[model samples]
Target: MSPSVAFGTDIDERTKAAEQSSTDVLTAPDVPWNLVIWNDPVNLMSYVSYVFQSYFGYSESKAHKLMMEVHKKGRSIVAHGSKEQVEQHAVAMHGFGLWATVEKAASGNETPGKGGRQRG
Candidate 1:
């Protein structure tokens, strides 16, 4: 096969792949955000920590840290990712008696991994 023919074939394949990638990106919905629970007067610190563990499965230390942030700082990014996900988290937080709300994560900071309370 001619060198030009081989190179042209590769270019065509690359272009097609790029087009597919662009399409996927364009069609993808923005990931739902998170509902962060702020510290409140009603819930005990330990109870908040327990809720984090029981509901979010965060480790004890991690849950404690977040709880402290809420207690001391008054708020923290307790949960994260897609709007729907955050809404669900907010509802769950409410059920647990923690205040929560959904918001878009800042740009250039995608891919929030798991960070919930510890398992039994």
Candidate 2:
């Protein structure tokens, strides 16, 4: 014995629409991402600044400024780039023992420092 299922007249159209929407979601354009460093009790402030300098090639003053932002504000978006680029930065930050994360840049928000400065 088998049960039969009925299909609605709009089933094909609905399926096509769903497929298209899924495709759109899958192929969505990549947006700029931010590499945010979060303050933590584990890492020293000097070490954090060093990571910013050595990793991102930021000047001593600029690195110290960003480091202070993290120390005072609890987090700071230190770099901005394509999703892949920021993700790679996040991984490198982790390797340096810094708490870091990547997130989509908020529309209209100013990114810290010169935006999209590629790591040297």
Highest lDDT: which candidate? Answer: 2
Predictions in order: lDDT: 0.58, 0.65
Per-candidate RMSD, Å: 17.0, 16.7
Runs in model 2 lying further than 4 Å from the true structure = 1-31, 114-120
Stretches of candidate 1 off by over 4 Å are 1-32, 108-120
For candidate 2, the 10 contiguous residues with the lowest summed lDDT are 1-10
What is the alpha-carbon lDDT for the whole of candidate 2?
0.65
Best by TM-score: 2
Q: Estimate each model's TM-score.
A: 0.62, 0.68
* TM-score, candidate number 1: 0.62
Instruction: Write one digit per residue (lDDT tens) for candidate 2, span 1-120.
Output: 111113347645534443333233223364467778998888999999887765555667778888998999899988766676667667667767789999888875756645323222
TM-score of 2: 0.68
Q: Please, what are the lDDT tens digits per residue for candidate 1 over residues 6-95?
A: 224465553444334323322346644545677678899889888766555556787788888878877777655445455655765776
